[model samples]
Target: MGKPKGRKVARHGGNPNAWREPKASSPSLSSVTTAEGLLEKLQSYMESCEFVVAEKFANRALERFPANSRVLEAAAECFTETGNITKARTCYLKAISVSPLKGWRKYLGLAQLLEGQNAVLQYTRGIEVMERELAEVAGPAQVETPNVPSASSSTEKDTAEIPTARDISNAYLSISELYTTDLCDDDNAEEMCKYALDKAMMADPKNPEAFQQMANFFLIKGDKEAAAQYVKGGLTLWYTDHLPPEQRISPENQQKVGVDYEEGSGMPGLALQIDTAKALIECAEYDLANRLFTEFITHSPTDPELWYLNGFSYFLHGNDYYPQARSALTKAKKFATTPHGICYDIIAQCDEHLESIAKVLPPTEDSDNEEEVVQTEDSVNRPEQSNCEDSDWETDEEGCEDVEM
Candidate 1:
């Protein structure tokens, strides 16, 4: 079949003269060269940083070649370098608009100038265009290594370096400090705390700080049991650490552990330790909380909040530290009195949680079940059935046994 009129043919299947050539151009290379010479002089003036001289030359060139790209670009550059960004940007846009091929470079230059002035939105849009042009380049992209580390790798290294219960604890506590001290947004503050907690757990599984942070997060979220478990875990670690700073006490022993206290940042890391202890207490990790509070007290001997938290932490332990709790409350009382004092308010509210332990405590007479029954003797009780409700209360059943609270 014959090809249709004006139909194209595949290269190898058709006559080679199918494509036509235009007649030789009237505007010869010499004429363009003549115009380029004028532009070069303008460019030289612009490069010399003499805006007046550059503008003069560009105006003269434009009179002869009103649409000359080089003249426009030179004038724009002069204005741009000499602090006339508004005018420079307008000229650049015009030059690029005059030629589709120059669009990307023009936009890139404009973006750079805008960025210098902090015009983020415009600069970012220009950057997008520039990147698109880069992607279109017909070659393998160069692999450029940044002088500074990549953010991802840098963060990973930072996370890796914070290994150890103390380090993890300090890290989380500092996050809290930033929230409380730097007045960061509450949501962001919480996020920062959570991030540190995740890192702390990865750094040291047994780090009390990690557990305590979880407890605090949950407590804030109102999950009491989960919070309690975390608090317990943290305090447990704190207790273990307290077993003996002796292993870590001797300089020789410290050297063996690879810890160089002498090479420290001189500013007492005491504040961090104190804050960690406070977190422990906040999550109701009482026993270890007391230990840490005591240690801090022994060291500083005058931190008012330490005294209050110490006494309150003991109070939270119920009978375990009834005497100590009273003592702490007394000391804390000296420094505070509002019904909502951090120590007193917490101590009082803790009474509700403490009531649970109080119920099952002090095995009642004739207690038969391995699981002790703790009936809420107070109004705070949830009104749930006690094991004492067995038929044995009135008659023999399941080996009736009575217990006293």
Candidate 2:
């Protein structure tokens, strides 16, 4: 009984509103068997490019293990990726409520979901979480490392995997950017920027963001020299791949920076800048390292550490950019956001380099008629007659490795 072939019927009028088939309902959480099974299935499905199936399992898993922090955390990441901001926020909240110390990740994700002052509060909360977690990790004022057999690989692994304050800085940097970018139209944003920058340094002194922001702090305050030095370590950079002669660590090159960044090579991240500088310095390529530091300072323009590293690189860079180093180190002293300690040591070293340079050089034209200058200043590692190897500068660098360049 088929309808007439070319029925001139008004389809819309015939059926004013079409009836739709009912959607299939998700499985009951109670019957999902176990959280482990759900998690495994979720992972397996995800790996097999079955995201719809994976999401279904994740939804069920959340229902069954509502208080499982891992499940909540995973949900937060998944929700975020899928643009489910509301669900992501809810999941992050549950995860954080259950484990505040481990909520830095969630805080960052949650911050992105909020706008204006609310986002700032979330970011602050994240910083606080990191502060508390770092304190907890440093529980014993000092850890007594007993001689353990190499066979105890598990113990070694435990030691290796333990989170440290430095480990938290990258997160702090990300949160701080929300303020700098003014995504939420922050009030007293500069202060907020500094707040996170301070914490970022406390978490990891060598953090590029912290260094860059600190430079910005100075720039915003109208101190261009300090700002420039903050990022560039106050040295005038010289581009070259070859190392200058060791004898060049004199007043003539005291303000010089040397580097060779590849053209069109995009700027490096904070960690990459630091690592590359460290490697260059270790290999006696002070000029190349100085160039890298300059790039960071040029790009970041707010990191106080870049200023310090700039100065440090100059000290060992064999360029004798001690004047710029002194200028940079002096400016760095203004911002004591952390107990990095190197600030003072570097200042002392700068004084030494300057004094040594003055003592060795023959009387200059300007000072020929002046009284013999009294050798009042203290000296650090003095240069050898004719040459001082940059290797000598590597001695005080060990402890700072954990902090920054």
Candidate 3:
């Protein structure tokens, strides 16, 4: 029988170079010819669903064009699919070494590889690097598209049904719980805090507590600008609804201070000052917090909680105000560990607060540990904190006081 018309026997398997774009379309294509033959063989095997043979073909391509970005990418992918993570990582590194011109694609692939291996820190670190590198390489002017409103920004749009409000609420709540519970996991704690902030924001947009929680999250992450935004949002909510703006200023200084003030006892004004001072401190607005702290001490210098807060704020400055921190913490010790007869709960809070601050401080020459564990400078969309576990929710009196405002 005669062979089918237009059919030709394949010679030396199909050419992998067939997948390479033309030089006119991609300048990178010119150097890609070295692996064309092996690429063709791999392509043919892949088409036939012969993964083992395809991987073998890819290995051969790597031998011929070890520094070819496309070949290395293909080899990495092949090894990854076959559960050879070590080899896959090596191939990916080779691809990155070959051509650093793939923009975000190379970093994105590396992120995937790191993620697959369950290296959460490494994966997040890769993303951070990619973001910075891509930003640096991007043109001065951004290519703007027509304004398409995001769902989060569209106020008039109906709230999409979450279908799992309780789950989401629990998720955020659980992350908040970690800040109060765990001590050693600053990295996970910060990530969890962000997860909580996002989940809580989705759960209740109108809740000032959610915004306040996010402010603390940013503070812990050392993002002053982001923390300030959330703190401002929370403060706006406080002034607008809960504690009328007038109550924010002291009545005694209303005329002299040239600001609106509550026409009553200074307790409310004192509380507002304390709360605002704490928020400012958390946002790294040390100058503002210091000014407020000076005024607060003039009014109630002996108050244990106020002393604790002032000392805590000072400690947060680290090396910036060592002498002041030493004095403040000494005063705080009088309220915390000394036999001043302070409330047990207040004393406990002081101890916990001091411990947390001490752990983060730079160690002295005689300290046992040289290295300190700190939160990472990376973002992560962590899994839901609660995952719909109903039994996790419990009433806590400590955080309840803040809710009243």
Best model number under TM-score: 2
Best by lDDT: 2
The pairs that clash in candidate 3 are 14-40, 15-40, 16-39, 16-40
Sort all candidates by TM-score, best to worst.
2, 1, 3
TM-score: model 2 vs. ground truth: 0.44
Q: Write the per-residue lDDT of candidate 2 for residues 117-197, one digit (tens) a residue.
A: 677687778767666555657783554433433322242234323445654775566666776675425566677667767
Per-model TM-score on C-alpha atoms = 0.32, 0.44, 0.29
Per-candidate Cα lDDT values, in order, are 0.49, 0.55, 0.52
Q: Which residue pairs show collisions in model 1? A: 364-403, 364-404
Candidate 1 least-lDDT 10 residues: 396-405
Model 1 regions lying over 4 Å from their true place: 1-215, 224-240, 243-268, 333-405
lDDT of 1 by residue, 202-247 (tens): 6567655557557767777777678777765654443334435563
